[model samples]
Target: MALLLLFASPLTLAFTLEDLKNQLSQPAVVTGPFIQEKHLRALPQPLQSKGRFVLARDHGLLWLLQTPLRQDYRITAKGIARRDLSGWQTLPSTSAATEQNRLFFAVLQGDSSGLQRDFDLDLTGEPQHWQLRLTPRSLLLKQVFTHIDISGARFVERIELHETQGDRTLLRMPESTSAESLDDAERNDFAE
Candidate 1:
């Protein structure tokens, strides 16, 4: 039947990792709302939190959380800083954290070749729509994240983080653009 054929075709289709690598190679800045669902193995239900993320290639990363409580975290080449409704605090960038930050920056910069050494990557779906799965090969990263799944086309659609503690957070990217430059404040807020 025609209907059966349509369903069967989709079930048998798959995307390769090379396809996903190519999709992520494009240059762009992505900013959007993100919903982080933290599922703990011991918890009865997953805790949901909402936030927004701004990522610029030359800049850094700005993560603003508006749900559960108001908070903001910025990661840049300088380091990672967090601010609550009250005040701002800077956190030391451990070697491990620096490595993680570099990894993220490298990926966003479209240096997929650099990432290959650190992650076992696999791609699925089609070029227009696909998922990139990155499993950390380093012992330090393996201790933190089990794997990271990124889905999207030329721009990232969503990022799913699977932690070693069995907690998973899903971040959805809704809006994105390419910028020639960012202001000083935006640069400071998103440095790494």
Candidate 2:
């Protein structure tokens, strides 16, 4: 649930940010499944949820959570929306929220400039598998998130979010492919 960033460049001795960005050179669309696990300090067991997501490069992302509870989230250039028993509700346009959204959109586009603007970026691991670690440098982001780590090969496979409040969320997208054969719902998911 973070930057879907990757690079297409060749991997040499060391994996570079340029390489990651290039690997993620935009595909028309990305559709996949995601598993989210949350560990709360107040609670002993981790909360687990599994779902699917569709990321359309030209539009935005449609993230659906089915287990634990059913929830559908949409992130567009304008803002974030969640579907519940009622309907879509726009999230408040706070600076932190904006930064988070930018992280998602930029990651999908392999645009790290926005990410660099908000976090202390660190690139490590090898090309076959690499990790992008981001530490919040801004006071606003720091208040909410301590750090975010995204790791994968050709696509974003895992996202680890560390919150300053002692809660952590692990989002893993094990499989993903170019959505060249999008169905009616997916084809129009991001239009609105």
Candidate 3:
């Protein structure tokens, strides 16, 4: 039964898309610390920034920066709201920008159906530690982002975004923060 044994061994290690989807557990809101480094085409060194973000499945993302400089971004039904020295202002919501933001949130929030519509996915590694590489399908999306790669050990720990203009951004959110109910900051963002 040596031939039978060989066939059985290979079957045991095969991992499917369903398996990866199950491995990713998306909470209603996942709050975590983040370190984002933007590598620009003209910049000699990558610009680093430290922040915290809240990812909500129904609402949107609340990104806050408390160090180096202060910045806040709240992505809600209205649009992407950014807070500067003046105050909170909503940016224009172009179709491309909206889709790009939704795609990022969908991938992180484990919305399998949303991801499947716009991206062709290739998953590598294993259940414990794995990578999901996405190639954009829509011509509009291709104009913005070339590819997106996400990796984690249980939860999503990192995201690398490659853009069409040759700029890249690497965001690390390895540390798990409180997944409890949305705080006051988060509540106000969605309320608006």
Candidate 4:
């Protein structure tokens, strides 16, 4: 009877969209390293980049790249910004860029409602492990993305972007840790 109770506990916590949002949103901050590979049809090899990222629930994402080149980017509801000698400079936001940024934030923040407005979401599996596929419902997004697949455990683990032009971008976050709040440096970066 005890064994049966132990085994059924996990199953009782069945996964649902709200459950996923709750799991993801419980963490105030998530920090990790990322490996991104962009596969282009015209290129023989995929372009790869390594970076560290900070995702603050109240703030935004800070992507610091250290690879073939070094660059920093901050993505917030306002827009995308790049770091340079002068400091954080806001990039010109195109419609496509705006849509992409919105998508990224929605996925990371578990804003399923935000995502539903633009794409048809198909989610499967349980809480500890699950997959989400986003099929573009909007004409503009359809031209840019074939579909987007995101899977994770406690936090998002990987994102696979399928482009309409036969290009693909795969992003992997092998390790992620959650925190109650951002560090001083991270908080300052978000402020900039």
What lDDT tens digits, residue by residue, belong to model 2 across residues 1-192? 233233423333566677777777657778788998999999999999999998876677889988877888899888998876776788789876876788887765556777788788898877668888889888878898989888887788888999999999998999988766567876555554
Query: Using TM-score as the measure, which candidate wins?
Result: 4
**Candidate 1 C-alpha lDDT tens digits along 1-192:** 999999898756655554455545444456667787778888898898887777766557888899998889877788778985555578887887888788776665545677788898876768667777889998877998999888777677777889998888776665656555665766655542
For model 4, the stretches where C-alpha displacement exceeds 4 angstroms are 1-13
Compute the lDDT of residue 11 as modeled in candidate 1.
59
Superposition TM-score, candidate 4 onto the true structure: 0.91
lDDT tens string, model 4, 80-174? 99999999999999987897888898898778888999999998998778999999998988998999999999999999999999999999997
Task: Give the clash count for each candidate.
Answer: 7, 10, 0, 0
- Model 3, stretches more than 4 Å misplaced? 1-14, 23-25, 84-88
Q: For candidate 1, what is the total of clashing residue pairs? A: 7
Candidate 1 vs candidate 2: which has greater lDDT? 2
Q: CA lDDT of 4 in candidate 1?
A: 96
User: TM-scores for all candidates?
Assistant: 0.72, 0.82, 0.81, 0.91
* Candidate 1 lDDT for residue 63: 82
Candidate 3 RMSD to the correct structure = 2.9
User: What is the lDDT for 79 in model 1?
Assistant: 74
